[model samples]
Every structure is written in structure tokens, then in C-alpha cells.
Target: MQITLMRHGKPVLAASRWLAPCEMGHWIAAYDEAGVHVDAIPPASLAAASTAVIVFASSLPRAQSSARALGHAAPRVDALFREAALPFPLWRCPRLPPFAWAALLRLAWLCGYARGADALATVRQRARAASAQLIAAAAAGPVLLVGHGIMQRLIARELRAAGWTAVSRHRSGHWGMARYRLD
Candidate 1:
């Protein structure tokens, strides 16, 4: 089985809202007042994954936008492959202190949220679950799964843990495409 994980394109922030008590210490909100559109990478990474059988994207517009650029005739949207939900919004995390960060991370862990497991162990478990489902579906075909940054990393990490050598990663939260082949 082979799979590829890709991050979403740029996104616009929604209306401003007050932070929750748990988020008080760990949130720092920013604005792109004129909601900005994420620029498409001149050349997309999906083209390199030409051998893929089907393209999949997260249920988010940003991801769908990037998947459309794959040059594929059709890209399927998959909700199970959505990005990990951070304890706080992704847009509100520039000023959080270490303790608060730890607290939120702990919160994520305490909950049954496997996507943001808050530890490498949890990441591996979540990745394996996703990979197992993929393997069960098509044990001998190439598939593309577009998701968020953390999930992508966890997927790559799980692939490595499952004995895939030669794993590589691009910059965080940036456009990325990874290929994995299972022997």
C-alpha cells in the first residue's frame, strides 16, 4: 500500500471572538482583516505523485483548494482525514507561554482526541489507525490523502515506525507531499 499526505493551502480567519478560560493564557489572536487567500505554489507537489489512483482532501476549503491544483480530474473530500484540532485555534498561538502550552497539550491528551495525541506515542497510534484503514481498503494501490500539518507529520512518523525507511519532511504548515510504499 502507498499513501501521500498533503497540507492545505492558505486560509482566511473568521470573525474575532473572546478566548475561553482555558485559552486565556495560551491564546494570541491575529487578523488578516481582509481575509487573505493562500497563494498556490507555482508548481504543486501532487504532480510528482502522478502514479496515485485517487486524490483525497480534508473537508476544509484550504485543503480542497490545494487538492484541486493537483491537476487531477476529480478529488474526493474526506472528513476523517481532517487536521488535528488544536486545543486553541491555529490562528491564536503566537504568545502562549510554555506552561499554558503544556496545559493545553495536557488537555488534548486527557481527552480521547487521537489526532492531537500530544505525544509521539499517541501520534503513532493515530497514524497507525489511519494507515490500517487505508491498508484494509487497498493493500496494493497508491492513494493520496490531503490533511493538516500535524496529521501529515504523524502519518509520516507512523510510516517510519511501521518500518518504512527513507522518510522525509518539508517545512511545517507548508505545502507538502509525501509518498510511502509498503512492502
Candidate 2:
């Protein structure tokens, strides 16, 4: 009854410079080289067939590419797992100063403070809700969800809060692996 959520690996940037959008409903860009390099695959006790019956990813090319490279069969692109849309697209403007970036991250966190809304809170809520749905729908098995960084982090937090045992956070790459042992 465990749900393992892992973030996608390192990707080549599709944009030359960071920019933000001036409005909402903008299409989030995908990673150019989004899959893990073969050499970067990490060792893991879990595989696609083991406890992983369901695989979900954000509706971004990078996420989908990563899932495919990892040999996840029929990985579904779930909108709920997509990264929180920025108030503006990051690539629309010149990169912000370091302090400004930090402030922006903080603001993003605050904005996602509620559930089922297109904010960070909503992403977390969706991840958990999806996980719960899988646990209920699956008789007894492990599930895999390939998602973005923020969504994975939120999932880990929720799992920790629910007392599920999990692996330490793994860095970005094709071989990144994190596990949650749902009781």
C-alpha cells in the first residue's frame, strides 16, 4: 500500500534565459533533454513492475520523457501533477536577482497555501488525493508517480505527516529514486 513519488531528472534548458509570464494560463515550457542519462540511473529496490502499477506525470514533455526513459509503461500525463503555474512565465522576463528569486519562491509557497486551487497547496492536495485514490483503487500494491520537484516535495511532506516511511530526498537525474512505505 505504498505510493512512491519521484521527481524527474536533470534536463537541458529549453530557454536560454529565465523569464516569467505577465498573465496566467500560459503554457509551461518543457525540458529539452529531460531524461536521465543511462550512466546516471541509480540503484533501487523498486522497479516498474514491483509495487509500481500506476505511473502519473505532469503534462510536460520533460516529465513524460523521463518516465519513458525509466521504462514506465503507459505513463499518464496528469494535469494535477503539473508544477504550479507561475503568476507569470519565468522565461518572459530577465532572470531576477538572487534576493528576488528567493522572495519569489517564498511568495509561491504562500500562494499555494490552500487546496484544490491552481496553487502550491492545490498541487499538494492533488498529489495526496491521487495517492489516496490509488491506494483505495488498488487492492494491494505499490504505485509510482513521476512528477515535478515541487509536487514531489509536497508529496513527501504529506507522506511524512501521515507517518509513512520514506527515503531521503534524492537529487535530480535519470536515476533518482525515492520510496514511501505506506502502512
Candidate 3:
């Protein structure tokens, strides 16, 4: 059985501005609500979507819209595939771009700074569950999951642990794809 994890298309919400750490919550909220940028979707992603017998997506607007943009009008939407929550530090100095803030906050979260977000352990458990669900779905045919980058990485790790071989390099960027198969 084969399963492919694809990061959703670029979000419509631009992350060009520098933001204070405390403002990350509002930024994240807006990002979660934003849809995909249709024009930015890679051609390879569309080709990958066409080959899947079943499509799954996170309930977040970006993922859902990405699925639709890829022509999966009725993908199985689930909160289980949502991105891991990001924790924002309260420090007011050193404002950074959204990407930098996200990276730094994610690293802090991994180091146990989950003041207002799900713990790393909790997200790992969820990844295990999500992996199992995807594996089950792959029993019938190829499965494509349109999901967030972090959650997709966790799920890919779980799949590898479960003996699935990577068929392609896992891509973490928007519109990137990773393919795996169980022998």
C-alpha cells in the first residue's frame, strides 16, 4: 500500500511583515482561516492528486481549499490532520517575520515551552493515530493527504517507524509531497 503526504498550497495570508511575539496568536488565527493561493500551486501537486484513489485533508481552510483546488471536491476532512499548535512567547522585543517566529516558537515548543499550545508528546500521539488511519485507508489503494507541514512530518516519522519505506524524499514546503509504501 502507498500513502502520499502533501503539504497544502501557499496560504493567502501573506507573512511578509515583522510581528511582535505576542501578536502571533492573531496571525496564526488569520492563517488558519485563510485559503490557498490557487495560482501558486505547483503542477506536480496536481499530478499527484490525480493519482490518488482517496484524498484526505485537514479541516483548516487552507488545506480544505487546497484539496478543492487540486480537484478533490469531497476530500475526507478531519481535525486529526490539523497542524500542531504553535506557542507564542510573551517577549515583546526582537520582532520577527512570521516564518522566523514560527521556527523559533516551534523549537521552543519542542524544548517544553507549551504555555498555550499542545505539548509535543500530545502531538506525537495524535500523529500515531493519524498514521494508523491513513494506513487503513491505503489498504484499498493509494492515499493522498493534504495536510500541514509539521503534522505531515510527524506522520511521516510514524509511517517510517511502522516499516513504511520512503518512496520519495519528504518535502516540508508548501505544495511539496512525500511518498511512502509498505512492502
> Who is ahead in TM-score, 2 or 3?
3
| Candidate 2 lDDT over residue span 1-87, tens digit each | 666666676665433333343322222233322444334544462364245776777777667766776777578677767765444
> Poorest 10 consecutive residues of model 3 by lDDT?
8-17
List candidate 2 segments past 4 Å from native.
Answer: 18-39, 45-51, 89-117, 167-175
- Give residue 148's error in model 1 in angstroms: 0.6
Model 1 lDDT at residue 31: 21
Q: Candidate 1: deviation at residue 28, Å? A: 12
TM-score: model 3 vs. ground truth: 0.95
Which candidate number would show the highest TM-score if scored against the true structure?
A: 3
Once model 2 is optimally superposed onto the true structure by TM-score, how far is the C-alpha of residue 39 displaced, in angstroms?
Answer: 5.9
| Candidate 1: residue 125 Cα off by (Å) | 4.6
Runs in model 3 with CA error above 4 Å? 14-16
The TM-scores of all predictions, comma-separated, are 0.61, 0.67, 0.95
Model 1, runs deviating above 4 Å: 14-38, 42-44, 89-126, 137-140
Worst 10 residues of 1 by lDDT: 27-36
Supply the global lDDT for candidate 1: 0.58
lDDT per residue as tens, model 1, 46-158: 46446667777666666776666565546777665655544444445455554365466546654654342245465557667876655554464777776677677776776
What C-alpha lDDT does candidate 3 achieve relative to the native structure? 0.93
Model 1 clash pairs?
A: none
Which rank order by TM-score, best down to worst? 3, 2, 1
